[model samples]
Target: MPHCVILYTPNIEPKTDLGALCRKLADTMLTVRDEAGKQVFPTGGVRVLAYPAAHYAVADGKGDYAFVYLNVRMGAGRSAAVQKAAGDRLMEVAKEHFAPIFEQAPIGITLQIDESPGQVYDGKHSSLHPLFNK
Candidate 1:
């Protein structure tokens, strides 16, 4: 299971569309899955969530900042060891796709798999929680 999360602080602009960014990132994630032959989240499994940084007082008062969290759930068939292996693959894809976006503004971006115990898959399923919530 491969999942991705993308969060960013955009440069000062007339309008900041976090939704667009989320969609772009999601699309990038899909590409990564295709290229890597790795399942990020599950087939037909993708979710995009966005939150204004101001909601959490992140990056000053400018809500232009955003947090994007993605979760990919693979199922319980894969063992924890295999899940982690898959996660590593997905991480590589995330870094490649996200690096350019982060370089543009140098905003806080975090992408990783969710290894937390309470995650949707955890040990029961092969899931990746790559989050970029900055």
Candidate 2:
């Protein structure tokens, strides 16, 4: 499972279409392929969520600075190269998406990928996955 969570300053939300960003990110995740050309991330296991931080400060709290932090968590299986490539692509699209905002204000965009080899406890119950698998 790959769950992408995006956190950004609320100041950027006015000029950002976060819903579109989420869709774009999810779509990009679906396109990641391994060396064998198999999908790196299963279609049903991908999720993108975004949140805007209403109360926050940037830099010395003097300028209008905004930040976008994207944290991607997934089960471990892929190689380091594969993960880096995916992260690169995701960051590329994210930069492209916020280009407008960048020009209008001071902003920082970051993407991080976390691979979980094993969890102490894990659980899942969903019918949505069946739809994608089928």
Candidate 3:
């Protein structure tokens, strides 16, 4: 399972389309595959969500600043290279989505991929997994 969460400043909403960004991310996740060409992420296990930050500070609490933080969480056992590739793809989408805001004001875009340890990560997603034939 891969859950992509987008947290952005409220000011960016007027210029950025969070819904579109989320859909793009989900699509990108669906494309990730291992060396054998098998999909790395399950189709039914992908979730994309966006949240608007009402109160925040960018750098020393300046004016007209926007920030976009993408946190992607998934199950453990993927190679470093594969993780990097996924992140790079997601970042490309993010940059394209926020290009307008980048030109207009000071915008900070960041992305982080976190893989939960298999020992501590307990998951129960049978329903969706079967639907996707995963």
Candidate 4:
């Protein structure tokens, strides 16, 4: 599987429809294809989870928020060039999809490739998490 993880805390508006936003983001990520005409995303296996911040103290806090986590698994045999291309494409799509919401937030923003299990040139592995493992 592709050995990269992109994790970001999208600064959403307080009390926004996070479920809808998550669905949209997931859809955008799932459909990305590489230049070789190969499907770069997992086979109906991308996972998106929305969790409210643990620091949420006030029930009526105007800045209440959730975390959007996206996980993708790709074939381990794919070339490094293909993997990088795919990852770059996915991030680009994500930024475009979430641009409007992010622009309105107080904090600027950060998108990170939090976990990369393989070498930048070549490697192989799979990722299983609490949400998708089930």
lDDT of each: 0.48, 0.91, 0.87, 0.52
Model 4, residue 123: displacement in angstroms? 19
The TM-scores of all predictions, comma-separated, are 0.41, 0.96, 0.91, 0.49
TM-score of 1: 0.41
Better of 1 and 4 by TM-score: 4
Show model 4 residue runs off by greater than 4 Å: 1-16, 56-75, 113-134
Tens-digit lDDT string for candidate 2 (1-134): 78999999988878989999999999999999988998988888899999988789888999989999999997888899999999999999899999998889899998999998878877889887899886
Backbone clashes, each candidate? 7, 0, 0, 3
Q: For residues 1-134, write the lDDT of model 3, one tens digit per residue.
A: 68999998898888867898999999999999987787877898899999998788888775887889999997888889888988999999999988887778999999999998856646574677678883
For residues 20-108, write the lDDT of model 1, one tens digit per residue: 65566566555433334654444344555554434344557555453333454443445566566655655555455455555554334
| Model 4, C-alpha of 60: deviation from truth (Å) | 23
Model 3 misses residue 48 by how many Å?
Answer: 0.7
Question: Which 10 residues in a row give candidate 4 its minimum summed lDDT?
Answer: 106-115
Candidate 4, 7: how far from true, in Å? Answer: 6.9
Sorted on lDDT, best first, the list reads 2, 3, 4, 1
Q: Which parts of model 3 have CA positions greater than 4 angstroms off?
A: 118-121
